[model samples]
Target: MSQNLAEPVAHDGCLLSDLAAALGVASDTADVRVTSVTSATDMAVPGSLFVALPGARTHGAAHAAAAAERGAVAALTDEAGAERTRAAGLPTVVHPAPREVLGRAAAFVYGTEPGDPRLIAVTGTNGKTTTTYLLHALFEALGVRDGLSGTVERRVGEHAVETRLSGRLTTPEADYLHGLVARMREERVEAASLEVSAQAITHHRVDGLLFDVAVFTNLTQDHLDDYGTLDNYFAAKLPLFTPERSRRGVTLIDDEWGRRLAAEAAVPMTTVSTDPGADADWHLATREVGLDRTEFDLTARDGRSLSSAVNQPGWFVALDTALSIVALTEIGYDLDRIDAALAGRGGLEARLPGRLDPVNPGGEGPRIYVDYGHTPASFRTVLTTLRGFTKGRLFMVFGADGDRDATKRPDMARSAALADVVVVTDYNPRFEDPAAIRATLVRTLEDEFPGLEHYEIPDSAEGIDKAVSLAEEGDIIFVGGHGHRQDVEVRGRLIPYSVKDAARAALAKHGWSTR
Candidate 1:
């Protein structure tokens, strides 16, 4: 799939000498013209500056010859990579850490600067995607041309494009991100919202771009495999609030992690809370949570209030909506205008794909929902919320990811205990044995909750079929783990699969109306 949705239109291009000076490195090819920059060799074009970094398995400098053949005029790499890139007959600019400077280099080549589109960045363990989607919707409601970058999809206003990368990522590589920003600029995007991940920060994926408003949603356990500890994971996200990354910040003080961040963040920040007792700059109180929508009241400590609702269930949706409105106001948008705009549109109407997305076949059958809740906390919240709306049996069909934090698998299983029936299935067992993943989950259920009824089905399609077959009218089938994902990974290969499609097919096979 093409990684870039919008290609760079045209620019005067940057001088290789200028890039060398910017990186504090000397380049032999001083006069070489660099029209663009790219990290992948396949994305290299004529007059392109190819950035080569050291990877876990192989060094990207090995691809210099291929990049040169693909019309990359220059190479940016570390001192070690300089030797190989020069050997490949490409002029090289040597930096100590190529990855750290790649974003700056791409921004220079693509002519993107901070605050050009009024950046709003959201970072957290769970609500990053939901909050960023809400911010993008608010931007549109304010009549601002906006761009969105997140886990599910990347959009430039109304056009959502498939990423050029091989797999979907929460954040794009720095080069692609800069290119995306350049594309947004060409389309006159006045503001944009980005879903920033902890990995994006640790890997320098968000380097060079400074956000106007940075938001920190509640953080929880999930990426312990990468960071080794929850404290380390939280620390990885703290840098996004520094002056180097963002101008201002908004911290959700619902949890201890958030409260710590509010006190520790270097940038001037506005604190918000869903908890009424906590003293926050803005307080979001959930008025009601219906099957289709959640109404909430947002009030500032200074007696300013805005009543609004989100077209989604759960109190979390209301919290995310209020956070979006507060972020908009912090970015200088008027509160009255935001209220008028939302009222004009009937409220905050944003569809969060794969985040509790409903898949109904329009029949008197089970209500199946597809959600991207992989973490233990997410599972607890989603299952508890769905249980309220379920009149009949609540079915949870889920699996843990391989090559990830395996420690949380048992807790994930425990969270599913809220459901009436638990169907353990494979979800992106990248290289680990899918059967083993299921065994861990099954053992957790059997040992911890012996009274709970459960089934182990390694095949996701068959698992969905089983869940649908058991469900009666008014029952709810909650398909968790693989939400908005088009493919499943097994043995390092991504097989074409969709949970929603599988659920719909299962419904149709069981005499339910699919239309």
Candidate 2:
């Protein structure tokens, strides 16, 4: 994938010495000009400042020569990398920790100042991508040009940047993030919504940028492979609500984590919840959950109420909508204008691609949906929502990602048990045994729900075909785990794949017409 979606059209290159001074580092180079900044050596261009940091497998300093060959003018690194970079005939700036300072350096290089494009950040275990999309759509509805950065795609106004490889990270690296903001500024984008992952904060990807408002959705058990515990995962996300990261905060108090975050957050926070009994600034009451839409009412503690609907079916969708609306209000957008925009457009106009995205909307034998849900909580929520919309049998086709949090595999099986039929298939089995991953899921399902109808298919495409063949009219098929992804990883190779296309082909093969 490309390191960044866009860059500023124009930038007066900064002196290398000035960059070092901004990073609070010492540099010997006096007049060297640095135009851009990047951590990846392959992204280096002429007059670029290459940040070389320590890595797990190898040191980035080892690639200083390659970066220099790619037209990099100077290098920023610690004492260990300084010698290697200097030996490669490039002037180097020495820092105690280059990764920690990368965002600041990139911000300085890209000329990104405070409140540039009016940043709004969303972070949590689930709903981050959808909330960001809703925020961006809300911006458009209010007649404001906006930029978006999230898991599915990045957008600058009407221009959408496709994910380069199998998938893009939920959040880009620090340098690329700053460059995206700079590009937004160039395009005169009035605001930008960023989906900040826990890993992004832990890795220092969002260090330099200060958000006008930071939003926290409900958190659940996820990313245990990185954090090792749920508490650690929550801790990783808490920093985004600090004064240095955001000026105001909006959080969902539906879960304990959200309530805790609201209490612990350093910035001024607005609390929101769907529960009527919960103490929050805003309360979201679900008025209706139709097949195509979910109507909700947001009432403030001060007795103000705004009614709206999301063109998606789910109570969770209502929560996400309420969070987005409350976030807008916290950022000083008029509540009446926000309500009018929603009512005028018949609800949120943003199509959350791969997020409960219907594959065969009109012409179809079975209603099929491709979703990006991977966590246990996400699976439970999506499956429960799909159950309400399904008239006939519900077929759940999904698999766990190999080399990820394997502890959640059994829990995932329990969630999928909600479906009438479960088809276990291979997902991205990167560097791990695909068969073993499938076996774990199969064993769990068989042991826990022996009477449940299930099938084990290693190939995801074949699994979809099996599900389609079994599904009758009015039935629903949900393909999960690889939503919006175009490829599957196995043994470190990204094989071309798409669940939506595969499901369509399967439907066609079963003598069903597809659009």
Candidate 3:
């Protein structure tokens, strides 16, 4: 894609007539003066151009009256919403697809020209957050101040803003995503690292933005409910590597999917792999992983060799770090500088939650960890990671989220089978039956790891308490699922709940002192 981002100020405070011609919105009377734009009706300001688009369960047109009642200057929407806006006596800007034009239209109204810093986009089924964090760390090591945006949160240098949204949907709405980027540009960040989701591309959320370098970590089982199949899921991630979407591409070739993506990507590309026989431009070797750190040797295809280290200890993260280095160097950061910025980069807090976290610094009790590992792949990895750290039994407390890909329930059970003791609990049930979800997983695990201690605690909070009460010194109690989430979905409302907080509370009640 073109490196030039559409100028935001090109049509700033432009009149309705001006906006119509520029955006190709046809109407008899284009007298509405558009001052701003927003997708959230609750946040709709007076004189703001509120976009009412189609939603999954209902039409956003249903909210047009509410948006107009909130003092929206006009509503830009499809035919149905236009009728509602006009009926409400609010001006209407009709479009075939309002969500598609949101970012460009918002940029037209509020954005400035693109800044100088290189923009790196990281995408894949998993590890996007960790990779982006690693890149930000790499950039910082290279003496570059950068901005971060991903599933975890958004940060510019040392300042971080908590993210309030769904994790399955990684791509924020177009208006918010671009606004964040514009703010980052204004902050003079030398580089911007973002996690691009397949959903983002499919929904046209990041449609107008340009990516300088795109990195693919690896794609595996995920979002199958939305995409419907593995092939469809893979197709969703392919857009970021196309020449029209990125200037350069980096692929982590450890997975067969990554190798295929590297072969098909239209842009100039570099491949990273930990597999010795894989055809990658950069390779990682001589790895070491500890509770607190990991080190590895990197051998570039160009004949340069380097040793690297990270504060994070996941063994699977080795290629992710290497991919970050390749993307940063290709985008122009020097090697030495890259290494330095990453020095201060620590593991994402509570990402794997409670798994590696110490229970209490001084208390004589087993270590406890809380993580959000709902997928089979994640379940297996977390269990394996904890198994390595165990001197005694590895106790796993986890559950399946309701109303999700039902087929994966068996896999999750298989992963939990690896643990010494498995206690099933409720995750976000949303609209689905929580008890049924728990039974499915519990059945799968029992079938494989029969007679292994298993408990079906439908309540997350109570279930966590059970696991902690069962903990003994030198044991590891892992409460998995709901990482970084502070709420639980029951019926339709999200009740306040936190996995990490509960784990800590349970540990404390079980005679463990705070760190």
Candidate 4:
């Protein structure tokens, strides 16, 4: 997506000398101007500066020629890549640590080293997307213009919003993130919220920019294949709370991880919680639990009692939305008007997607929901919640990712066993046998509860069909893993797939008509 700006004020390109200065190096012989910075060979355009780094098995310098042919002006890389790009006939800017400095170089090229738009960053294993989107909708309700970057979609703002990016990394690479901010400035966006993944923090994707407010959503077991342990994963999320990364912090102290972060945060911090036992900036007490909503009251640290409700059921929903509320209040939103804004925004469901979201395909049928709960803890919270509400029976359809933390596969299966019925199916078996993954899930289900009745459906789409066929009018069927994802990775390739679409198609095949 491109923006239209007045021609009277021209956008001056970045000089290579400025980049050299930022890198603390002297380079007068290769002085030149570049319009953009990139890490991939295919994205090189005229006036682009290619950044080549060392990958796990191969160096990015391997594609130097391809970048040169695409009109890339020069290259920035480590010493190893310098030799390769120099041989490809392009002058190189060598740095000992390229990835760490990549963001500064990109900001120099994009001219967004520090730009407009108040930035808010949310991070955790779960609820990052939901919290960001909740803030986005609240801003909209208050007649404030904003932007969003998260797992479901990336929306760059104008009077008419343009979803410039989607279905990619929760946080983009260093160069791309700075480029995105440049675009946001072009669109006249005044505020924004971004979901920061732990992988992004570990990779230095958000290193150069300082956030206005940083949020913690609570950590759980995830990404162990890359981190190997919970402590390492928590360490990866620590940088975002340091003085260099954010101006202030709004932490949710609902779990032990969150409590520990609030206790040790390096930046100024405020904490929120849904736990009745928690002592924080906000403490929640449940008032009512209904099929459509759960009402709660919060006691602020300053002795003000505020009333709120998670417009959806589940202890997790209340926990996340409570943090969203406290975060906005800390960001200087008027406390008295907070309840009015949420009421005008049509509640949480209208703002966020894929978190305990019910998908109604037809009339007088079983209640069906599609959620992004994949971790063992998430599965237990979701499956058990639905089980309590089902009048007839509870059916759960879910699976785990291949080539990921296989240690959690049995844990996921055990959680799903909480339902009256369970279907073990493929989620994303990238480069792994789908049937073998299904066998592991089913075997775990059998071991956990001997003679437990469950179905082994290797294909997710077909598995959804099987789950729907078994549903009665009063039953609740829940599908997990690929919540808002439009595709699934099979043999390392993303194939077009949708759990919501599959559920609707299954209902249609069963002669269920839309009301």
Off by over 4 Å in 4: 1-10, 87-89, 113-115, 158-167, 289-291, 309-311, 343-349
List residue ranges in candidate 2 displaced over 4 A: 1-8, 161-167
lDDT of 2 at 14: 90
Q: Rate the local accuracy (lDDT) of all candidates.
A: 0.88, 0.88, 0.73, 0.79
Candidate 1: tens digits of C-alpha lDDT, residues 1-515: 33354354467679899989988889984479888888888888788888999999989999999999988889999987989888887788999999999988988888888878889999988888899889888887889889999988888877776565766678989988888888788778888999999999999999989999998888888899999899999999999989999999998898899899999999998999978889899999898898788888999999888988888999988888888899999999999999999899888888788888888836668999899879999999999999998999999999999999998999999999889999999899999988898899999999999999899988999999999999998999998988888999888788999998998899989987655
Model 3 lDDT tens row, 9-103: 22345576666666787754847776666687765656777788888887776777887777777777888677777876777778898887887
Measured against the true structure, the TM-scores of the candidates, in listed sequence, are 0.97, 0.96, 0.89, 0.92
The 10 consecutive residues of candidate 1 with the worst lDDT sum are: 1-10
Error of 3 at 494 (Å): 1.4
Candidates, ranked, lDDT: 1, 2, 4, 3
Count of backbone collisions in candidate 3: 14
Better of 1 and 3 by TM-score: 1
Question: For model 2, how does the per-residue alpha-carbon lDDT over 1-515 read when each residue is reduced to its tens digit?
Answer: 33244232478869888988887778975458888888887777788888999988888999999989989889899998889999887889999989999999998888988776899999988899889888887998999999899887788788875433233578988987887888788878888899999999999999899999998887887899999999999999999999899999998887789888988998899999878998889999999997678898999999888988888888998899889988888878989999898889888877787899888889768999889989999999999988988989999999999889989999999999999999999999999999999999999999999999999999999999999999999999998888889999888888999999998899899999887
The Cα error of candidate 1 at residue 463, in Å, is 0.6
TM-score of 3: 0.89
Residue 430 in candidate 1, Cα distance off native in Å: 0.5
